[model samples]
Target chain A: MQNDIILEATGLTKEFLGFVAVKDVNLRVRRHSIHALIGPNGAGKTTCFNLLTHFLVPTSGRIRFNGVDITGRSPAAIARMGLVRSFQISAVFPHLTVRDNVRVALQRPLRNSFQFWRSDSMLDRLNDRALALIEAVGLAPYAGLPAVELPYGRKRALEIATTLALEPEMLLLDEPMAGLAHEDIDRIAQLIRKVAADRTVLMVEHNMSVVADLSDTITVLARGEKLAEGPYAEVSKHPQVIEAYVGTGHG
Target chain B: MSTRNVGFLLLAVALVAPWVAYPVFLMTALCFALFACAFNLLIGYAGLMSFGHAMFFGLAGYVCGHAIKVWGWPPELAMLGGALAAGALGVVTGALAIRRQGIYFAMITLAFSQMVYFFCLQAPFTGGEDGLQGIPRSPMLGGLLPVHNDMVLYYVVLAIFLFGFGAIYRIIHSPFGQVLKAIRENEQRAVSLGYNADRYKLVAFILSATLAGLAGSLKAVVMQFATLTDVTAAMSGEVVLMALVGGIGTIFGPVVGAVIIITMQNYLAATGEWVLVIQGVIFVAIVLAFRKGIVGEIADRWRAYSAGSRK
Candidate 1:
């Protein structure tokens, strides 16, 4: 496999009040590869994701995305540059219809989303594309239903569908399989694989089996630092990595 | 009945309302209705609530009253000037207030409007407590009807109200409006989707403020006077009350809300100090019984019934 780094973070650290949530972590996400960040509870997995996505300002660090320095950039600007992050919790627009939720994600491409004079019927042009996205996520049956009305697993699908609608070059999935049931997990794993086919994915997942199955490289974070990094087979066998998980009585 | 059909029925009532009822009273309700609707656009659809909305409403009244009295400008031009003035103010205040969220945002707007209220008090053109009086009502469509006729003035105010209402309706149904709803639902998710949520918010703020200014200008022209009452903090609360009584997010809720509230105040004048106590009781009763406001409750029931019938 061609190993070109698509996203690189150097010495990323974040301090909240006086507490250091994330400390001196360097990460390299490969081009068109699945990179997983996993750790037990209180390991700063979500904080690290926020720092990389510029949602949280780092106390000290540098981040280069596709070779461009993106530190201190606005979240919206980072997203426009094709680095999109999904929330760890289900974050679909609850009151909007499933199709309308997808359509909102499509709005970022337009130069202006502020034509207050025109009727929404003019947006029929986007209906086909929005419907296509909804179908891909297995949410076609619930297209007209309000997102809040969907079952939890279906809401996750809608959230991912909304994220995918942005057509990001690098997708950051924060615990994509965090709350899924057994059947839902398999479908999401399949969807993730399908989406990561032509794009890079960096995910923070706690599901060990999922981490083992889907990751090209697993970066094990323990107590705000990288404990080990490599293929899941090699990293899983690392002495300190094993000790960190076992000592903490983790899953 | 469909919302569209209900809308048509309301329109029919408004057309002949002046002939049957007191024209001035109907015109006053229409102005307040437009004001409440403009206020609703921010709080209802955009999830923004400004406690200082009277700043926009009052400033436009001052500007419109001044223009008619001093510049000798026609009615249309005065209203346009008033709306543009409010829009300009919106741009300045919205840019600053959107820096914070929730209560901070509300406080920022309230602070800005408090400053504006004091400015209007001391400003030479505002006439301070007396306000700008004798704002002449110009001929509708350049002498299309008698300028002195309350019916003609009624039609002009109605035209302005319809225009504002139509614009707001278009905004609420447009692609832009959908984005606002998205932001309202989850601002963080909206931002992550590459929307400069602040920009959308500022645009909505400006639009809402401009329509509110139009309402204020109409009130000045109708009453032939723009008083300090229009710009007071109490006026802001009154608009919010109207929205709550009608339904915060429903389109026609503001109109229904404004009419009911205004009618209560107007007809209850005989009781003097008891009017306030009576209005309070009635308001509490409506809020307690109809949590969604009248139209919102009615709309919800209608939706549930229709869905049940289909099943």
Candidate 2:
């Protein structure tokens, strides 16, 4: 079980000035599992997620990924190591076409991003792969359209496609279904499950149904501390988890 | 029209402009046009608004003027020296300026450029108030062709302009350009995708400064003098105006903007301070009526028309 863990966090804590946003918490995500971090608003889930991705420095913690200590690494360095993250807000380059947005991500691992002298036509070689990613995200029809013009749901899909272009070993999605309509939520939930088949996914989400359907392991948090952790069937019935959710007025 | 057709048309117009227009005036416009185009590279594509670009432009002019006047270096070497000097300055300034974004970045650049301006005002080699005078246009092609003739010098400036402009066009269409645009549109997203956004911005800054230097060197050779005006903050504002009026992001926009502005300056020489008022009015009008700029607005309209026609 220890060897199966791809990402492990020990005693992770974050504080804003004097107020603690996330208390000492330990999280271990096994390889190829869809792990969900669910909490009501102000539950410190986003803070924990930000700390893990190094967007915010952990007040005190040790983060190990694939057996290497990764706490204090820059976000780009962490991403380069295949621990890519997606923003809660859809993060696509608005001026670039959907295909170009994915291509920009694809260029990162190739290490040819500084080749300014080469014609962009040289990037045409990535078109087949880029289009495949677009199709996978159900954005093939909008491949050539500027991402700024994309509808809200489609923009989120493009963000996922861009993140997937990195081909990460572990993916951290921050509220992957935030602002999504009901129909779009179902599509994205299905998309997330399909992508999770080959990779580890740790997500912070408020939508419990999506969590129950996709998460193999569920961790519940409230007021900056973990409340419960188990398979969804077991964790959903935990009295403390129910009380925390209900107490927060989210029941 | 297709981009290829536009390219051909521009090339044809450039080739024939010298015969129809005053060669000296045309050369002056070409030099400024290159300067504005280089300025546009940073502000338009990289989303960096550098307020001290004239430091590169004026400093390169001083370097090229000194090399030609005192060292008697060949014309091409002098220009290359100026460009390389400006590129090195870019690396130093860009490293500092890129640490801040938006208005702070602009302020830092402005401060650094002002320092350069003061240095130029007091530096012994720069001739202070008198400026570097009578910079000779030396012979080219191993002394086979002399640049003493205005027409010959015009061709040289035109060739340099085309080369510099073409280089910028190529960069904007390259994979590297795509990443810069990504950084411009959403820097945080670009970083999440593993791009070192600051490094890319620095490279772009250096490239823009190098090209600006190239234009400045050409201007020094053409005018046969490097003056304090070249390094002034006003020069920086002028380049920005050209880029904005022509179209901030469009390929040929700055060139068009430069020509219009330069021609206005030439014709309105007798208007004295009214010229400033006219320029301000034009800027205000551009901001209010067509914020995309002349070429940008035209391009947008063309796209809309084409889309409608297809429908």
Q: For model 2, state the Cα shift of residue A131 in Å.
A: 1.0
TM-score of 1: 0.97
- Model 1 off-target regions past 4 Å? A1-3, A248-251
Candidate 2 C-alpha lDDT tens digits along B42-88: 99999999999999999999999999899999889999999988999
How far residue A130's Cα lies from its native spot in candidate 1, in Å, is: 1.4
Error of 1 at B192 (Å): 0.6
Error of 1 at B136 (Å): 1.5
Worst 10 residues of 2 chain A by lDDT: A242-251
Candidate 2 residue pairs in backbone clash: none
Q: What is the interface RMSD of each candidate, in Å?
A: 0.9, 0.8
Tens digits of lDDT, candidate 2, A93-210: 9989889999999887677778888888988889999999999999999999999999999999999898999999999999999999999999999899899999999999888899
TM-scores, all models, native as reference: 0.97, 0.97
TM-score for predicted model 2 compared with the true structure: 0.97
